[model samples]
Target: MEKSYQAAQAFSGDLSFLQEPADAVAIRHQVLILHCLAEGQQPISISWYKNGEPLPPSSYIQQLLNGSLWIRNFQKRQRNGTDEGEYSCAAQNRYGRLLSRKARVQLAYLSRFHRNPQPMAVAEGSVARFQCLTTAVPKATIIWERNRTELVTADPRFTLLPDGILQISGVTKDDVGVYRCLATNPANSRYSDEAWLTLTGSAHLSHQEPVILSGPQNLTLTVHQTAILECIATGNPRPIVSWSRLDGRSIGVEGIQVLGNGNLMISDVSVKHSGVYVCAANRPGTRVRRTAQGMLLVQAPPEFIAWPQSATYAPGDNASFSCVVEGVPQPTLAWLKNGKYVEVRENTRLSDNNRTLTILRVTYSDEALYQCIAENSAGTNQASARLAISLPQDAPKLPEKVIAFPITSTAIQVAWNRPSPADTDGIIGYVLHIRRAEDPSTQETQEALSKMTFKHKLMNLEPSTKYALFLRVYSPVGISRDSGTIFVTTRDIVPKTPDFSVTTVNDTSIRIDWEGAPPSSTIQGYKLEYRKMPCTSFQGTQILPRNQTSFIYYDLEPSSLYQIRLVAFGNSGDGNDTHRFVSLRRSGKVVPDPSPDSEEEHKPTLGLIFGVCVGLACPVLCLLLLFLLYWKRHLCKRKTNEGCGHNVQEEKTDQAIEEERDRNSEEPTELLSVNPTNVAEADSSLGRDATRVKEDQSHEPPHPAV
Candidate 1:
């Protein structure tokens, strides 16, 4: 029983403690607990070990009732690096012993000395960095400070690193100061030595000489013009400016003035002020001086060289007038008509510096008094002329609303109103001229008795033809230009049949070509009709524009004959149709029809006959099979009845035999009472007779009657 118990308590898995101390911790603040388990059996003793040896009892360590070893206030015990090592616990019983895996424990401490922060010198707009290094068991949080005050790392210019490094970006003069770093943790806190930052660059100071930013340049001015000169300068301290003439003359005298910002102004300048001027800039307590100069000029005004003269001209004639001028500075010249400024137009032109005014195709409206004017800065001049027109007579104007009406198929009546009084000269008679616009050879002329009569009949004109007509008035003066041309047309006549030909024909469409109707015919459109051959009436008709010389008819029957007709229509009526016969066949080739016998042979007769015969014979065949099955079943039943009859007969025979034997045995009993001796002999004879009868019955066949 002891051995069995010992086997049950054997260790089965790796031995390890349930709870172990952290790998590293601050001294005097750490505690370690080692809980060990021995499967199946309680340990007889549990103890703690350090460095592979039994640990001596001390105020810092103890064992608990639950097989756990506890350590408190762990500290460094040796100076040769023996203070940190593995710790373990052992549990033992009567069966076996187990030692738990080693758990390491280390005593932690703060660094002994803090490193000094590095001093840095950087140019403005440059980055500066300071470092603080130290040795510690646990990583410390780093803090940056400047001038004894903590700095917020959220500022974009300052950065604090975890390893006690401080960075200042874009360092300016204001960033120069004392910097310090602080490192802290749960064990303790320490600060590094202070560091100083210095900045040096041009951004810290400003020093420059005066620079001329803008100044006046050489210039020229006309007489009686305003002049202005400007000079601008820049320096560390603002500079003062003064203006004077280079010829030792004081400015701001005799209409000359000085403006703020070193600009000189001269009003209504004259020839005396036409000289170089100087501008000077100076700074207080500085010996440096700057200067700029500008020049001026005065010019004379214009004067006339020759005066213009008046002139006369007839209507429709070209005329011109001349004037000339001269001055120190060229002057601008202009022309005025009747005291109003003359503007250049299609009929008027100005040339020779506006010294000459020309009129192109002069009319009554252009007759007026004209003047020439010249001007300059100093003075002005003028000249004048008169224009006129000379004429014998003016052309008669065209009448309004000329109209024409059809009088006959080849004639038209034209009428109009008299010309306006202002345009008509004394007239005696009028002449009418008419001609076909399309054929100028066909023309006619007629004379009327008086110009007052404004009606005439144009005779012998072509039907459906456009004509150009005009009327003119005549007197002692040459006949007036013909009035505006008027176009007129006689009533239309029936169009002639158009000449056409079949261009293309196909199974489904037919294309025809034709020459368009003559221009004189005035045909509006064409009417096309088609029908199958031998048909009386035509199918639907299509109307085509007069310009359409070709048309295609669609949806025609294939392998069919057709008759097509084309007729031209005018305002009067449609002309006679030009007919043609056409056939719609494939590719213009006829395919012969198949023979009737072949068509019939290709029909599906065999499949139809076979299907019909199968449909009718299936029920007859099924009835025959049913009759055969019934006959077979009937024969089987008849045979079964015959077998049963035979079995019944044999059974009846066996029953009879049993009855006969029973009767015989009863007879023997009766004989025993009659005579004992005679009974024995009688019984023997009866037995023999019974055996003989049985053998005969066995040998005999069944009776058919039974």
Candidate 2:
């Protein structure tokens, strides 16, 4: 059984997370736990992170075996450390890694009200309102108290908003008493400043429209600072003042409050708070109001979110650096080299809003420290990275185990394994050195090859010829020393005929069947040529895959003779051809010629099958007999050498041994003794007996060598 393992499955269920940390609010000095559990490949490790950085191990903060973070005596504020900010966890294994959702950890505490309930005088039977707002994490709950007693909020006459505002309708004399806000949270509870609510008789009170005594003025401040917009108003029965953004954005209650009757105070202001503010003063129970407006501009200095990373590259390669900054008004970006501005040209340019700098076809002189500067109205910032140029001194190692095979009479296939990964770093491509055995090195032809290619074919060469070949590996720096030379002899141009039989399938179709060749990568496909008999010119050709051995030729003239040819092809070129002539009658009956020259065509289908079987088995028997003869001869030579005390033996190099092994595995010994240079003796007894089948087609004799 195979062992099962899974990497970080990302969102897949294999590496499922049972629980993840969530936003939490804990009281100071209390223990807090954040959960992160995952299941995946064995030997998985879990790590905790805080504020986007790894959290250092400490006694105060510990990670449990189950991948949960436990904080002891969690501190909201400390001189050295604080238990706050965002927290996340990661589960990792050798296969992959995954990160969990980020969770914010905040101390739970409610601050004293920036603005407490103030004394107000109003007429009885009119609506009355009171406001109490405080800053708190996880939000604080506020309850109204009448004379130290919890007010009945269940009464329909009272309404409470999420922001700690209280409203009362049909105020009676019973409402006249000391009123305050009691705020409670996970940390502690406190009461706001007490204020007495007084009411006069409706008839005795004089009504007046609300009026703004002062309006907030425009203010500007930097980030992480505070801004105050003052708005004071007065009216009979007192008016209620509220704040809003002119752009219709929320006047968020966090770090924001109304102080001293109607003043707006914002703490820890950021660029997001830069907007126009509108303050409205309205009389209680009526829409009569006055308004004031102010603009608060918050500015921030340029800060980098993405920086260029250092890298190394060879000459003629492209190099690029990117720098990204975020600030108010979207900071402008610029590029510099070694503290000086870089000249912009066609080869060196900026893109993507001037945030990216690209140097095309970088040369050695282009190597330098690249800097990116961003400037805005607020401030400027810069970051830099170094670009190092490398000119390798060592070329790539030579190709491994180079060997060549005779693919055809005029073509040879050369293949080699790539060098080990460690020796291939700077490799750009390969070069083949080809020459005849008797030729000078200066006369050798060089063929360039792609770095990724491992096998190549050398075509259009002389048959029955000897050639010497070697390989050279090239890199950006230089070329490697030539590999050991290997010699290969091309085969004589003698193509073997395919044994096939043609049978009529219909009035216009006849199927040709042949035995398939043994599986070999070199066998590319097969070609089928057919036409009417005695025409010399073929009509058309059809190519079939190497695995296919049968084809049907259709749309032939009825009662007409047709000649069909089938031949196998390899990477080199076409092989021998088998031709057969068939005649179809008007009744769709097929007939074969019975001429003495075409005896095999007159055989039945069974006889054709037997012939094919015998033909294939003959090659195997011949190969076995040749191996036996070679082995006997080798044994006899060894015995004779031992008997004569002749221990002389030739030493073979690693390259020579590999070449010998490849040659024995790929090539078969030819039986004929014919020499390429002596064509006059080609018809000798040895050639006639060695095995060359005679083709006796009626109109065409056997094809001789070209």
Candidate 3:
């Protein structure tokens, strides 16, 4: 255990004695000496410490033998409040060695004061007077102070009457705080009890600057909404603040009601309030000074003009919505479902009412109208936008036989004649979202519709690539319902019709393509088909999944001029059908003219010709015959001639023939005239002719044997 200091050093003398702490409450003490016993040695000195600080850096109590040397009185110590503890008395010899033990005195708050003053209260708007009314047994004299400064000592604002009355005339609120009175007599003076003075009067400015302020720096209100306005100001004497409407109207309570503060205020401010507002401050001391300039802007509420005004959000799905609002006070956005704040991961959930609100990993409970409110010192503005959470009533069911254009395939044009009746909130838009069909993440994209129409034409699809598509409807009342899927494939041909009627139908179908090509779009094929009126099964629908211009209706009855029209389908299942009327584009036939060389006499019997005939006994014939035809003819003729003239020619021919034959044969076959060692040498090579079969008798497999 650490032991505290007992008594640093003690003052003692054999001539007399001093009693220990005799008074428990009264801490002042004195050492009484009946006789002076100290002579040869020396008198002792007393030192004090309020928790280790010398009582006085200069004065130390001395045990003087004469009356001048004697310590007639002693006092306690003080800290921030006058009274501090830990006093020690020390005694030492001139030899700077031997001394007596020490004595300690503990003092508190006001200390063992020579005197203390009492209360002196005064009325508002009146001259204030305070005096140090204190009495020490030795009859202490009086002095005054305010803050830490000596009141009557030097301050011109303060004066002391010979009668000891400390007075300040016509005192304003500036003199309202705590003040202290000090009574001085000789070595020590007691402080009067701390007294406070408050003056009642008009407002006064305490702080400097033309501070500009608005209602509340922090507020949430709806966009394009109305709200109140105000500002912040500080001063003494309580300056009066008033808020005024731009349209001219006085604000705040008046007279007997104490107009309280004079900050101007306006109710229901809209875009009209988006301007500079001046806050006027007036006080008795500080004249009328208005705020430099403060601006108030009224913004609009969350009226969603974003990617998705309404959508179906599934559990653990991402739902992003945005809104732009305007109001006097800027708005704040908070996402709530069924009326409660959402707590998602920091990044996944966000509120930037200034622009948009995003919610990731959205759940069913997150379906509700999110309110983005803007508020200011005046009032609150609010706006609400709705969201929904739902899954398709059921997965899509592939449509029945769809008669699309030959250019359009792998798809069908569908407008749900029948959809799930469970759609209560009505559908907001249809989602033609398609995943990799192999991935697990349910990513999605939604195409919103302008109306509640059952028909929607989708385009740009990969042939034979299956997709999972669902529709979700929304109503202002119930935004959480998603309709079941109505699976409709896209036409193989790029469908370009805004909407159409099929006409001009016959055994062979034909239709004019009118819908413009899709932006940067490509198509693969088209499908064509037709069934008799009221047929049970599209009797037979021709799926011409290619870009076939016209298709013959093979399924129609023979000799039956059936009504038929073509519908073009692209690879992505988007298609457009020709008018229902079967209008055949009478195809023009061409007749070739007779050659001028007159091989076959002109059989003008019936036909007249208009097309030019292209003939080529050379260019044309070249395409008709192969190089092998010349080889066969030359090969047979070479054997018939052997004269030197014939031989020379035959030799050239034969040489050419031999060279050709040699070129055709591989080294292995030519090796019949060489040594076996040479054959072995050729076989060892890694060249194509060696490693692979030699370029000879390419038709026949080569053998190692010569």
Q: How far is each candidate from the true structure, as Cα RMSD in Å?
A: 55.6, 27.6, 41.1
For each candidate, what is the lDDT?
A: 0.58, 0.67, 0.37
Pick the winner on TM-score between candidates 2 and 3.
2
145-196 per-residue lDDT for model 2 (tens digits) = 9899999988876766555666665678888899999888888888999888
* lDDT over C-alpha atoms for residue 322 of model 3: 59
Question: TM-scores of the models, in the given order?
Answer: 0.25, 0.35, 0.18
lDDT tens digits, residue span 1-706, model 3: 2211112122121111132111122235543221122222333322223333433432334434431223333445434333323332222222111111122233312324333434544444334555454334333455666665665545444545422345554456556667776655433656657777765554332444433332322233333433333344444443455444454544333321211133333445445455554456555566655543355665543232332254555556666655554433443444433223445566455655444667767654454545444434433333344455544445333222222221234443445443454542243444333332211123444666543455555556555443445444444433333333223333333444232222223323323222433443343333333333222112233333232334333223322222223443332333444323222223211112212222243333111121111233354445334344446545544532221121101212323323332333232243122111121232222122212221112122222220
Which stretches of candidate 2 lie above 4 Å from their native place?
1-24, 29-54, 63-73, 77-80, 85-105, 113-115, 153-161, 211-289, 294-316, 319-354, 357-706
In candidate 1, residue 414 scores what lDDT? 78
lDDT preference between candidates 2 and 3, better one: 2
lDDT of 3 at 243: 46
The all-Cα superposition gives candidate 1 an RMSD in Å to the true structure of 55.6
Q: Of the candidates shown, which would achieve the greatest lDDT relative to the real structure?
A: 2
Choose the strongest candidate by TM-score. Answer: 2
